[model samples]
Target chain A: MVEKTPILDTLTYVFLVLGILIVGFPIIYALIAASLPIEDVSKVPMPLIPGDYLLANFTTAWTKGNLGTQLINSFIMASGITIGKISVSLIGAFSIVYFDYRLRKIAFISVFCTLMLPVEVRILPTYEMAANLLGPIQSLVNVMHLNWLIDWFANYDIDISLNLSLLDTYPGLILPLVASATCTFLFRQFFLTIPEELCEAAKMDGASAMTFFRKILLPLSKTNIAALVVIEFVYGWNQYLWPLLITTNPKMMTAVIGLQNIIPQADDLPFWNVAMAGSLIVMLPPVLVVLLMQRWFVKGLVDPEK
Target chain B: MIKRSIFSNPYLPYLLILPQILVTLTFFYWPAFDGLINSMLVSDPFGNYSRFVWFKNFIALFTDFLYLKSIGITLMFSLATAITSMSLGLLIATLANRALKGKAIIRTMLIWPYAVAPAISGILWLFLLHPSYGVVALAIKKFLGVDWNPVLHGGDAMVMVIMASAWKEISYNFVFFIAGMQAIPKSLIEAAAMDGASPFRRFWNITLPLLSPTLFFLMVMNIIYSFFETFGVIHTMTQGGPGGSTNILVYKVYQDGFIGLNLGSSSAQSVVLMSIIIVVTILQFKYVEKKVQYTG
Candidate 1:
C-alpha cells in the first residue's frame, strides 16, 4: 500500500467537509427553524443560533397538535405493520428457500418482480380492495362485534377502516403498510445465504419444517431479522402519504402527520421553536434506528452478489 | 427439511407462499384486472360504475391534452432524476471508495438523507424554499438579488421536484455503487496501474466496465422507483399544482382514484403503468442479465 501525499490528504479533508455540509445542511436548518423564536423566525436575515422560545414553542405544539396521541397512534400502527411484514416475510422466505418445490422458479420470480412496483402503482387497487373490505365495518355497531371468528374478521375491518379514513384512527394509518415486498425480498436473499446442508441434515433427523425453521433458520438469520425489523420499524414510523390520505381525525394522526399539521396557517409562519420542536419529535426515532442500521444496512445493500 | 414425499412436499412450499400470494392477489392482481376492465368504460375515475364500454379510457387518455402533459412530465422527471442521480452516485461512490482516512464518516454522512423519510425531505426543502422568509429563499434573494419562487411556475416547480428527488436518491445510489465497487478486486486495479495505465484510464477500462452489473441493477431500480415513489415528493411539495403541471402518472392515479374519486380511470392508469414496468423489467433481465459479472 502506498501512503497518500499531504496535499491529497488535505484535499480529501476538504471534500469530506463539503460533503458533510451538503448532507447536513437541511437537518441543521430544520433544527434551527424549529427552535427559533416566533418574531425572529420571519426576520430577513435568519438567526444562526438557538433562541429563547424553544420550551414554549414545544409546549404549544405538544398541546395543540395533540402530539402525544399521535405518537402513540404511530407506535401502534408501526408495530402492527412491522409484525405483519416480518411474520409474513419470514413464512414466505422459509417456504421458498428450504422447500423442494416445482413452483420454485415462479414463486421466486414473482417475489422478485414485485420489487419493481413501488407503493404508488399498487395503491390504487389496494385502495379499492381495502375499501370494499372495510366499508361496512367502519360503521359504529359493526365495530362492536366480539365473537371469536367474527372478531378476526372484525379486527381486519378495524384495521382496514382505520387505514381507509386517513383520519384520526389507528388502523387507517397502519393497514396499507402491513405487507411489503422489500421486506420479503430482503428475507429471501438472507435465507438463500444459509447452507442447504443443515436443512437436509435436519430433515434426515426427522425435524419437521416448522421446527427446523424455528431452531435452525430463525437463529441463523437473526441479524437479517434485526435489520428488517429496524428497516420496517423506521418505514412504518415515518410513513406519510398513505397516512395522510386515510386519516381525517387530527387527534388520531401519527407523529409525522402531527408535525405536518402543525404548520401555522397564519399570514406569518409560527415561531421556529414550535416548528423545530415538532420536527425534532417526529425525526428522533428514525435517526436512532439509522444509527443502529449503519453497520448492517451497508452489508445488506451489497449482498445481492452472494 | 421435513423431507416429505416430493409430491406432498411441493404443496408445502406453495402453502408457505400462500399468504403472500393471497395478499398480492387481493391487493395487486385484483386491482390490475379491475383497472384493465375500467379503462375501457368511459367513466370518471370513480364515477360511471355502469356497463362496459371498452377501450374508452385508453382512448380518452391518449386524446386528452392534460393526460398527454402528465405523460411528458413523468418521463422528464423519471429520466432526468435517473441520469443525474446515477452519475452523482458513481462519483460519490468513487470518492468514498478511496477508503482514505475518515471514509467511514463520509459514508455515514452520505447516508443521512436516506434515513430522513422522503416525506420529511420534501417538507424540509419546501420550508427552505418557502419563497418569503425561508433560508434558501432568502439566500437567493440576498446573493443573487432575484427571488426564486417555485410555487407559481410550472417549469420551475418541475425542475425543483427533480432536483429534490435526485438529492434523496443519491444516497440510495451511493450505497449500491459503493457495494459494487467493493466487490471489484483491488488486484485488478493494481495490475492495470502496473501496466502503465493512468488513473483515468484505469477507471474507464477496469472500474466502470466492471461496475456495470451493479450499475445495471440500480438503473432498473432507479427508473422503476422514480416512476412509483417520486409521487410522495410531488404530493408533499407541489400537490400537482399550477394547473396539473407536476402531475406524474402515479400521482394522477392517486388523484383519479382517491382525490378525484375516479376509480375506473385510476385503475386503467394502474394497469398501464404496471404493464410498462413489467415489460421494462423483463427486458432488463432478458438482455442485461448476461452482462452482469458476479466477481467475488
Candidate 2:
C-alpha cells in the first residue's frame, strides 16, 4: 500500500468522478436534449435529464433531416474504404516484410513518404485528380488508337466519357484513401515478430510463399487484422473534409458531412432537440464500436507500433 | 527492423506490393509534387494563362499579414491544446491509476471519447457555447453577467475551438499516459515511498522523469494533431469566422485554395505546411523512436 490516507483516497475518488462527468457531459447533454421536447429544449435553462419525446425527436431527425440516407452512405463508404485499405496494405506489407525483391527499399520508402503528406496538405491537387482523371486516360487511349475498346465497352451499356469524373462515387471516396502508410508500417512490424524457423520449415516442405501466407501468416495475424479493422472502420466512418469536398449532392453525404447541414445557424429559432438527436445518431455507431470492442479498440490505438 | 525473405521470387514481391505503390504514386506523391509545382506557377484568375514565376508566390505568402496571423494563430492553438490536453490527461490518468473502484469501467468511459469525431466535438461545444440560447452560454450570462457570444467575438471563438480540440484529444493522451505509468517498475516507487518521500515529492521526482519519453511523444502528436486534424473542429465551430481570428494554417489553405480561388498562394501555404510536417516527422523519428532519455 502506498499510504492509508483516507482524505487523499476520497480526493482521488472525487477527481475521478469529476473527470468522468466532464468528459461525458457533452454526450450526456446530447442525449438529454435529444429526448426533450422542443418547448422544453427551447427554454433558457434546459432540463438535464432525458425526457419522453425521444422517439419523436429521433423520427424528426431521421426522416426530416435526411439522416437515414446519409447513414447508409456512411456505412457503404466506410466498408469500402476499410476493405480497400486493409487488402492493399495486407499484400503490400506481406511482400515488404517477408520477401526480398528488386527496389524493395524504394517501395518501402515511397510508402513511408506518405506519412508526411496527409490529405490536408495535398488538398487541391488531390481534388483536381479525383475530379479530372479522364484527361490523361483519354489522351493515352487516343494515342494508342483504342477507339474499338471504348465501343466494345459501350456495347455493354458502359459509356466512357472524356470528362469522366469520379466525384460523389463510392470508388472516388475509397480509392484516394486506400493507400494507407501506417497500416503497412504496423503490419510489417507485426510480421517481423513471426519466427524465422516457420518460414525455413515451410521452405523445407516445398510450400510456396502464397501457401505459407494463407496457412501460417494470415492465421497468425488475426489480432492485428481485427485491430486494424476497428481502427480503419472508425477512420473511414469519421471522414469529414474529403467527403465534404468531393460530394456536393446531399444524397451522397456521409453522416459526418451531414452534421454541418443538420446544425442550425445561430440567429434562427432552430430546434435544439432535433439537432441533438441528429448528433447522437451520428455518434452512435463509432461510440458503440468502441464500447463493445473496448479491448481491441484500446489495443489498436495504444500499441500502433506493436 | 529488416525481416529476411521467406521466399526467393523477384516477380512475386513486385506483384504483391504493386497496388499500394500505385495508389501512393497516384494520390500522394503526384499531388504533393503538383502542389510544389503549382506554387511556382503564376496563374490568372481563370488559370487560362499561367507562366513560371519562381518564388513570387512564396514571397507573396510570406509578406501577407493574414497569412502571418494564421501562422501565429496555429502556434497559439497548438501550444494551448498540447499543454491543456496533456496536463488534464496526466491528472486523470494518475487518479484513475490509483482509484480503488471501477477502474476498468472508468478507463473505458474516459477513452471512448477518443472515438468521437472532431467535428462532433465541435458541435457539442458549439451547442454549449452558442451565443443565443446555448446552455452554458446562458448559464454564463446569468451567473457572470457577461455576454458570452462566441459567434461574434474572435477571442471567444478561439477559446471555444481550443476547448473542443483539447476535449477530443484528452482521451488519447490519457491512454498513453496510463500505459507509460504502468510500465514503470513498482519497486522503484515503493522504495522511494519507503525513503519517506511524500507522494507529491515522489511524483515530481520519480514518476515525471520516468514518463518523459511518453510525454515527449504525446506532445509531438498533440502538436501535429492541432496543426492538421483540428480542421474539422475549426470548420464546424467557427469556420474561421469573426474576421479570421481562429483561422489556423490548414483552414487558411483550404479557404484560400478552394473558396478564394488563389491556387498559387494556397499551394505556397501547402508547401510551407508540408515543410512543417517534414520537420515534425524528423523530430518524431529522431526523438520518440530513439527513446530520448532524461536524467533524473
- For model 2, how does the per-residue alpha-carbon lDDT over B26-87 read when each residue is reduced to its tens digit? 77877788889899998876978778899999999989999999999999999999999999
Candidate 1 Cα RMSD (Å): 6.2
lDDT of 1 by residue, B113-190 (tens): 766666666777776776776778777768988658778878768767777787777888888888877888888888
lDDT of each: 0.71, 0.85
Could you estimate the TM-score for every candidate?
0.86, 0.94
Docking quality level of the chain pair in candidate 1: acceptable
List, residue by residue over A53-156, the lDDT tens digit for candidate 1: 66777788788678888888888987888788888888888777667667777876666667656556667556555656443334334346444345586665
Scanning candidate 1 chain B in windows of ten residues, the lowest lDDT window is B1-10
Residue B268 of model 2: what lDDT?
A: 89
Quote model 1's iRMS. 3.7
Kindly report which residue pairs in candidate 2 clash with one another: none
DockQ per model, Cα: 0.43, 0.69
In candidate 1, which residue ranges exceed 4 Å CA deviation? A1-4, A100-113, A134-175, A265-273, B1-15, B44-49, B142-146, B292-296
lDDT of 2 by residue, A181-271 (tens): 9888888888888888988898889999999999988998888888788778888888888888999988898988887877877666668
In model 2, state the lDDT of residue A78: 85
